[model samples]
Target: MQEILDRAKDCYDSGLPFVVYRKPNETDVFGVFQSNDELRSSKDFTEKGFVFAPFNDDNQVVLLQPDEVWEGKYQTEKSEAIKDINLDESGKEVHIELVKKGIQEIETGRLQKVVLSRKIQVRITKPPFKIFKTLLSKYPNAFAYFIHHPKVGTWCGATPETLVKVKDKKLKTMSLAATLPFIEDETPKWGNKEIEEQQMVSEYIGDKLAHTMERLEIDEAESVRAGNLWHLRSEVRGTMLPNLKVSEVVRALHPTPAVCGIPTDEAQKFIHKNENYKRTFYTGFLGELNLRSQGELSLFVNLRCMELQGDTASIFVGGGITEASDPESEWIETQNKSKTMLGIL
Candidate 1:
């Protein structure tokens, strides 16, 4: 464990590119370290290494080849200690207005739902390892990762949503949405807004995968907890077509209703027009693309993530908006989502 940590820190300190991650509910950690800093893009998604993709398809999808590899077990038996994180509310007014416009778009029959997001910069008092350690212990069910490269800088996350996982001809993915702060010993009473939002995502996923999968099955939505929030989630699984490629499945589901809106293209266009900021890889996907001879794939939707720079960190958070959304309440939802990363910081 000490040797792996030392190598990772050395790679980061020397400005080399690398990615170290642990999949959800997995004990072993795997790392892919680049020998030198160089920008590489995986356009066809055939890259046999770790990939860090962007929210928008227009941008280049960064890839880091596993020139050197490391693997070890990380203790998830207990959580690491965390210091209090100081966060100030920012961009509430702008986000609220954005949510209003999104609701209006839905009311006018333009979109059923649109996901909106914001970023808050908070001072960091510890190194990246400390934060990553806290994340690994805190969220055992999340795809926790720490990635750094000269081109993309540094981005780390504990994402709960799997973009897609392929083992041979078998394929599995998740449609997760709706958010409420988690309580200790009670079942979540999901409202209409939450139920509809989750259903929209599941339907969108099913429709998208209908062509590629030989058979599709979507289970009932269930309540799952991640960090300080509870989300309504459903699993969509099936067997792939005879010649279905992993890249095709990935591109088709890049921006699901969970991250974007019902009519994905239009909602994404509105987000680009009104958000007034680049999301980069915040709501994007990341993780191992192709591994070993069987060609297994595991990539996750980047949520509850932050970009680190100098002494401050940029934490990103967002929520899905529908006609039932209240501007003020949506604003509050974003705040609650932010605590997932903020609390561990």
Candidate 2:
């Protein structure tokens, strides 16, 4: 671990990119250098020689070949099977209660922010990790990461959040992911609440990207649901100024408002104070870098994720909080989102 960390630090210092991975055998560490010798088209970046690492338990950031790619996805029908599974609180009910709680806290001036989370129970008659591995292999674009420590069993996920994407003069990013279990025939809709949250994320990102890019284009976003929840997503594209570096863009976009929350610092401080848990790598971004190419970057938000051990999986889940948010509902949202991975278990 120390050696890998040292190598990473060295790469950072030398202005290059690298990836460190924990192989399936558990205990084997591997490292790869991103090819930055040339600047290939962005299309090539998504199609060839890409690798991925754990961005968080549920999310993975991928570095692709810009050419070689596979099409894989899993969207389950709204399962009566899921209805049978036990959940801590009815999601709708929790939303109402948590919102009231958050409102009261704000009303009383206790906290300006609080992130709530809940767990959904899943019963599996078959081996859970095996099912997860199958899902990981299925999504060729997603990262297949699992660690088998004595403390945690098998952890895996196929995340879709792009923490950051940097090219020579361009940087792009997305915001606001909500997780819920997959439902059959669920079409994408731009509802009021979804639009509202997405708007906030877009505004925040536009502000950040403005400082780094000379020209920026914000797109009309659609709804994307990962695992059990749905998120409002917008694509923000910008061209970096002559003096800016790719690392600067990455540093600016990480832990965006979608995954973290608005009033970033205050929200993070509140999370540390009240969430009563350590996020560790849960929300951190991870992916490969193509130092050999002109520096193509693909990152994902660490959502719909879990930590895998031999026989036990310690799943980590959370939700974003806003001044307009409800704590109970946030809790249920995380629970519902956890279903993305929990269903397999």
Candidate 3:
């Protein structure tokens, strides 16, 4: 475990690019350290490297060349809450206003749903690797990673939503949305808004994949726990069409309704126009791409994530908004979502 992080630190110190990650429900940690410092882009998605995509595809899909690889078995140490997590909800009003606008868009039939997010920048009291250790330890079922590049800086996250996982022409992904504070031993009573919000994402994914897949199957939606919160989740799997380009499938689902909204382009326009800040790679997906031996692709949405710079950790949280959404409740949902990262901090 120490060796995996040690090599990552050495790579970062040399201003090179690397990604040290542990997949969900796995006991092994993996690292991809680029031998050079070149800032490479994977536009065609054929690159056999680590992919770091941005919310808007207009930005380059930064690829960390898989020059050196490391794998190790790791034991997770439970993260203890150290900081009094009083997040700066100063943007609460702005986020609520954005939610209101989304509702209006839905009411006027411009969009069926929209996912809006806000940032909370908090100071850190620990080193980057220490924080990553806590995060990697805390979420045993979340895809945890510490990725650094000279051009892209540093990003640490334990994402719950998966964009895609492809191997041998078989692909699997999930529609994950709607958040609530998890109460131990209690079944989450999901309301209509939450159910419909998740369903919209599932249907959107199914419809999109219909054209890209040879056969598709979607499971019933269920409640799943991701750290301190519960989310509505539905697994979707299919057989990819023979010779279908990986890039084509990724483009079909990059900004799914779970992250963007129904009528993706219109909601994306709303997000870009009203969010008032560059999301960068917050809601984007990142993971292993094109393992030479297995020809695999495992990617997860960049949720419950933060960008680390100096002593500050900029956390990103968001929720899906339908016509039935409440502004105050949405803000609180983000607050609950932020706690996932804040707890480790």
Best by TM-score, which number? 3
Tell me the number of clashing residue pairs for each predicted model.
0, 50, 0
After superposition, the stretches of candidate 3 with alpha carbons farther than 4 Å from their true spots are 81-84
CA shift of 302, model 3, Å: 0.7
Model 3: clashing residue pairs? none
* lDDT values, one for every candidate: 0.87, 0.53, 0.89
lDDT of each residue in 1-345, candidate 2, tens digit only? 445445544544454444443322133334444434222222223333444333232333344232322222233223323334454544456455655655565556554434444333344444543554444444434444432222122334656677777766567776654434456788655445556667777888888878777899888877665544556677777888997766567656766777666656655565555444566556665554563355666566655566543455556666655566645556656666665566556
TM-score of 3: 0.97
User: Candidate 3: minimum summed lDDT over ten consecutive residues — where?
Assistant: 78-87
Q: How many pairs of residues collide in model 3?
A: 0
- The per-residue C-alpha lDDT of model 3 at residue 305 equals 89
CA displacement after TM-score superposition, residue 91 of candidate 3 (Å):
2.1
Per-prediction TM-score to the true structure, in the order listed: 0.96, 0.65, 0.97
lDDT of 3 at 244: 92
Worst 10 residues of 2 by lDDT: 146-155
Clashing residue pairs found in predicted model 1: none
